[model samples]
Target chain A: MKPKLVIPLLIGIAFLLSACAGVGFRSDTSWPGLTSDGDTIYMAFNQAVYAINASNGNLRWSYPAEPERDRTYFAPPAVAEDGTLYVGDFTNGIVALNASTGAIEWGPIQLGEGDGRIVGGSTVTGDLLLVPSGDGRLYARDASDGSAVWTFPAEFNEPLEHPIWSAPVVDGERVFFTSMDHNVYAVDLAQGGQLWATRDLGGAIADSPVVVDSKVLAGTFGNELVALDADRGRKAWIFDAGDWIWGSPAVRDGVAYFGDLAGELHAVDIRSGSEIESWKQSLDSRISASLAISEDRIFVAAESGILFARELSTNEEQWKVPSRGTFDGDLHTDPLVLGDTVIVATNGGDPLLCAFDVENGSERWSFTPGGSDKRCRSG
Target chain B: MNIGEIWDILILNPMINALLYIYDFLGPTLGLAGAFGLAIIVFTILIKVISLPLTIKQQHSTQRTQALQKDPEFLKIQKKYKGDRQKLQEEQMKLYKKKGINPLAGCLPVLISFPIIFGLYGAIIRSLADSPSPLLEFSKHIYSSVSSTIIPLDSQFLWMDLGQPERFPIPALESIPIIGDGIPILAIIVVITSYLQTKLTTPPQPGSQGAGMSQMMGIYMPLLIGYFAYTFAAGLALYFVVSNLFAIGQAVLMNRFKSEPEPAGKKKKKAEEQPKESGVLSLLASTQESMMKLLGIPPKSTTQGSNSSESAKDQSEQSGKKKADAKGS
Candidate 1:
């Protein structure tokens, strides 16, 4: 063959190989975004937001009706008191859909001129819908009309250097959120005025800040779980987890239960930031999602595709179920517990959402949009 | 281990760490703004330097092939063995051996660099972990030496969110009719630089069978790269532009330092005959002339000087032939 043709051929082959390897030029990937309003659970994954019945796992309705190629829905939807679902897409656009009929209520209103994305779910507090954008601004829009109430930075020109991937948690009058800039910010819920921002937590935070007992608790990739004073944003205490923490700790009573990426689940005293005695369990699988706590049991989803239910008091494993025949069975989103069912979303699995019995490790029902032959089964 | 595992261990992991390390080091010094972009530029240059020897070898092989194609003896052999495929192959091989040229030499370095280029592309994608799942995947590949604090490398470079396809918005163009949306400036630059690189590095094939293929390659490569630049992340597109410029510079430098002097007799004969213009140069000139015509500007008369030179050489040739005829009588 001609030597001149070889380089182009090699480039074409390299691109093909890169595509096959799933390491294409566009580098974004996300797990399903799951949220619940007791009776219905809204799941945002790939192209459309799915509303599934919490009781029977039946499809209520999906917004957009047909999937869009350009738009992707991965942020968990924020449901208003009026039964309007407010969700953001990866294209930096927000839309409000009627919960019952899945009709477009207001928008697809674009934010930041399509430069940034909305990775974290929005929050509906009172009449205000707090949307955390990847453009590093937490926007407070009116829940009724999807109109902008106030932007966090105020100055549109000076935005945060990094994206905000964590949802804003509203506590009373103040709302707290985490940014990839390695800081936790507390802003006024009404006017979007910044109250305070914590000094760099030494690593980026990808999960929402949990406001518990006058302390804002957030896990960071800095290998520690930090507790800051809710008002002043001063560091209250830090619990070293031995590895990067990617999920917010499940706070129950006075203890925060969370797992590190190294698969070690620890129960830490939320007041003192000290680990509880003999309250650490190693699952031998990476845990990148927040733990879900019900009455006495805490559900832990591992990257190895196994879901384990452990006693919250003793950190002892009660029952473990392996999500088999799915795409790696990888679970990366926070699990939601509504009554007897604990629901978790998978990363590119056959069934997008799966629900298991909270009492026993049995599969109750699995929900996959656009029904698949190979359903996700637990063993 | 599987191929994927091996690739991650050897290529992807190291590149990821290198990018993180560079970003971390530059964060404090460079003020944390556009540091990741600077790191990418530095990393690309580092890869180019590491593969310099292979690139130089490829350049030398290309130069030798071009010289062999222009050799009078090789042309005579091709003419003599025109109807015989076996004889042509045998003579070509003999001439190649006598000239100490390896026909396959140019391909080996390109083959070796494929993994590096592909690995770099993967590293850029993995490094710019913009979302959750990608960040989780990226976390597993971090080296112990590199700090986890750099979990999310800054994707902001100038007006670009390096993770997204780049566009430069012009507020002034907003009032205009059609192109009110932001211009894809990076993709345009990618096409231009890719074409320039292909033209500069691709040794001028005059009348060889591969000349048309080479010309087609010059057009297709830029379009392919431009398509990727327009659709993919801006970071990868930035890599393409920088790599193309670096390769073009390297080719020019290699050509300057490594070119052998022509024989005096061949030089004089060449001067008396019509100068052989390279396929790439002529194609570029014609393209420029066509664009000029389309824009209603008459092209500068480039052929006038060449035409006068050809006429003077033709008159000198006729005079020499007449003198030779007189001697024969």
Candidate 2:
């Protein structure tokens, strides 16, 4: 190629490829709901909450937690020990409601100074909910009351201009999170103190960290699985994949599993940090949402709104949950796991948080929230 | 200033005025004063024809510089002076001098066209949308106030006005069907024609530039023109369509007469067939001329030669082509 022409052509190809590469691939990955606390099902579809008994595929109680007309929820609710539900809203702030009565606890912990949505739900370590903030800060709220405790402001650490987009993880006293800075940081959960950060995490970390064998495993935008020692925050190992790894990690036994934006399910050994097995799923869109894995099956939500399931051992096709035809607010409201029953929030049309029978992906019941002024009145 | 206001001054006003001027020039010729279709065509053709020299210069320069695309010595210099940008540029200039090529010659024509483009834009803004300023109003008035002895600009052309596209008015619906829609059938047609024109005129900028920018430009420029047509008056859109078609015609015309080099070894056989009596005659009378100084006589006048055969060839070939051509004549 002529240098004059090649110079521009290479530049253009590199630019286009980088842009497209940054955007994760999509296949048949769906997370109808995410797993929280290994049990208690917490799903959000415009703030409707359905408690499905984890042991049985039965709906315990469902309440339509009122949401602002302009706002929507992007992820599932974080459950407190006292049954206080903390969830992020698209237009407003972090909301705390009584889990049982679905009653409002206090004002939603509004993020930032401007008009921006709380992009993702909070992750709780203690009374502090260490949630990723779109305002570019990790916020800690009082677990008892929906009050701000402290904030860990985001910082630039990457040579390239990649931004932080994933959920944060807490390991021991240190909190591990990924940023556009291209580093995985282990910060003190209490004071936002930097314990240790890997300089080369290779792309943004949109996925929340998964702790297994005292090692932090998280997927990055570069489609790599990075394992770091939980206490010291040293790099354990790295596994590069086909595309971006935006979805959060799911750990089972000694095997750590995560889905990439490329719609491929990867199972890596926690000890060696090597790919034990990999399965490709033909998803229509990228899996930006987290993966909800049970003992035998893993559920992934493709950006195309289709919920895909596969047997973990055999990597065989399970069942798929179809999304509503219109208006998908956000699909990564992690599936709620209540033993044998799974509750998921549905996007499109009138949004609702629906419960499904675990053994077979069947709709148990649904609770739609929004367009109401009444705050939950709990006794 | 805000972006909208900046666009209004630079892009909007100029484009409007150009259309309005063209409308006056071709309006009566085609018959309709308000429809303005004929004015648009004439103006478009005029703009393309006027920019012919620039386009040709750009194309010729691009072709001449093709040999510089993958020069090994160029690559060596680029590598040797990788970090030193100034030195790299100096080396590049030296290389261009050696090959008798201008690096910027290709881009200069395109860059020169930007000013005319700005004028056309000014014409588009003032006349079509009727949001006139001192500059645009001055232009419109100046065009209108021409002498009777000179060519008078008019708005009437055929069944349509030079200022307007074909608009179907539904009395029950509203005053005009396309007033607020921001896109009309005529505008879409113009945008599509402009896009095709761009594709035809633009040297296929090698596939490496990614379809993103070019593809984006292809799609986006049309979409942008369409959007403007909907928001602005029809006169500007008509101008765009006319200008694009003119470009297409110009490209075909210019390319048809372009020069090419002969195939290898064909000239050597001819040289052997009609051998010149003298070495100089052989060099000039035939196409055996290699060195630039081979044609220049008076060996004492010429300073130096570099090739192994340069000194011998220069002395022997100095005084021969006249008798050779005379014999042929």
Candidate 3:
């Protein structure tokens, strides 16, 4: 070995190692994932699930109710018919909590050798709980006992790296879901068997598919909104966007309202798969949160923390509300429309729960969960 | 397109896609932790193998330059053109041209391989993103086939969280003295292996000018990598350890091929000609010399008026007798 060889190699290795070191400097806070049932809002932030009052945005009780590193929540909590809230953890497996009391109902269920972490929230149909995991399979578990009912890749395909990321959308007897594996899968809800799979859409589908009318609509990394026949798993039509479509489309009447990764809000004719001429407006930022529709107004939040309220009929901008604080921008959770108020959660750097009036987009109340002061603050 | 966009499409995107494909194929049986860890080793080896021709050329050029430095006449030439750097460079180039050897050939290949290695480091960080925005950017770069196969790669390998720095296995372990839970085991391994690899591969510079600098780098490189390993994810530290060991093995095999075995009598004669020193002191000196060379520092001069001249004479010869006399004085 020569001194010449050693010098250059060391420099190269040093560069490589330095690049690896950058991973540690990243912030620990994660984007918020929220879901609401009636007057209670379930918010998953950092590592815990918080149950907040929907009306004034106040904390009710948080599951675990304390910071714990051994477990972490990545997906928004899903509420079941029996008042059980289901959520996925980044380290620990799926758990069922009492939605009313914030108490553990079933688990830290070890899905696969106590190693699997769920990426999407659980979709409960009847007694079955479908959880999409980083393990490249969707585990169908008994909702009551947290026992495995079935798995998508029963034999486990080692070559296919496709891990389900989107939550499974249940329609009638079939459950439709999209995966990084590039295809939309239609599985039988009762049997947990593959019913039909759409052709690869040339991109990864990270958001859950929405079944609108007779079609299943999904956004993709390919920068297209694809609509497939719900029954046959055939492509109905596709709407091309300027950038990758990450947010799931919200359907109202015959039009689908969604925002792309480019932050442009678009309204498309669901039947014809054409962009509505008057309903397109550029928001000038990236949008990863799904749209929330309430009556004639459609609410959407951007990653920059700007919340927009637009008219459903003309796509006219109704009112714009900036993020609450310097720390309260970078919203990732979908805006939740509860009666006359619209609620949106923030994960820019700080964790905040804010509510605004639907008519004028005025700040009604803002709550910072886990704070000593749990009451809503005036704007 | 902007510079950032161009870089994304060219270096970053390709590397990310390649890594994803490798992870996908290996992940099923190995699990994600095993798959990614193994994939890095394979990718590194692949890069080495692909650049073997260039490496060989670089090796040849360096060896040729070193061999020319040994020429007694080359030393005389340096002594003659001591002060005039321009004439010294001219003479050296003339000599290289006559000998048909390229001094820069060695550097070009290493330079060429740099971007690939750099791009690979970025790809690993971006691809293994545990958050939303980076993942979104990662998604855009991946090919449909590779993207579809793997998303949200499992970062758990053994007890290590590949996405986080390696620490004590449990909180209870922190109570232990000295080697507490805060000590990063993988980082320690990385530092040790890097030091060993550098020590094993560094050829003695002996009287060369860069010897001291090389010795310093031997110590510095390991510490630098150790710091990175301690700070970054365990996955990267794992990559460093494996890559260093592999490099050590490659260096051994390459050196074996480069140098032929001498007869016992010749070896004895060569050993007898070497200067004698106490075993421990000589060993320590040799270690320092190795570090100096690793950092590209030149050694101090022992011969009168001929100290910096050796590096200069490797390029060319003096113009006339007048220039030679001036250098001689």
- Tens digits of per-residue lDDT for model 1, B82-187: 9999999999999899878988899999899878888888888777767777778878889867887776887779988787788888998987764576788999
Each prediction's DockQ against the real complex: 0.29, 0.02, 0.12
Candidate lDDT values, in order: 0.82, 0.56, 0.73
TM-score of chain A of 1: 0.94
Model 3 steric clash total: 28
**Per-prediction interface RMSD?**
3.9, 25.8, 6.9
Candidate 1's TM-score on the B chain? 0.77
- Tell me the tens digit of each residue's lDDT in model 3 across B81-132: 9998899888888877776878787789879876766677677676677656
Tens-digit per-residue lDDT, A275-314, candidate 1: 9869988888888899999999999988878778898888
The local distance difference test score of model 3 is 0.73
In the range A48-149, model 2's lDDT, one tens digit per residue, is: 445554443245555444434555555556776767777776544777777765577876667655333454456777778866654456667777776667
Better of 1 and 3 by TM-score: 1
Candidate achieving the largest lDDT: 1
TM-score of 1: 0.86
- Compared with the true structure, model 2 gives a TM-score of 0.45
What digit string (tens of lDDT, one per residue) describes model 2 on residues B225-263? 566554444555566666766665554444433423232
Ranking by lDDT: 1, 3, 2
Candidate 1: Cα lDDT at B93: 92
Q: After aligning candidate 1 to the native by TM-score, how far in Å is the CA of B294 from where it should be?
A: 22
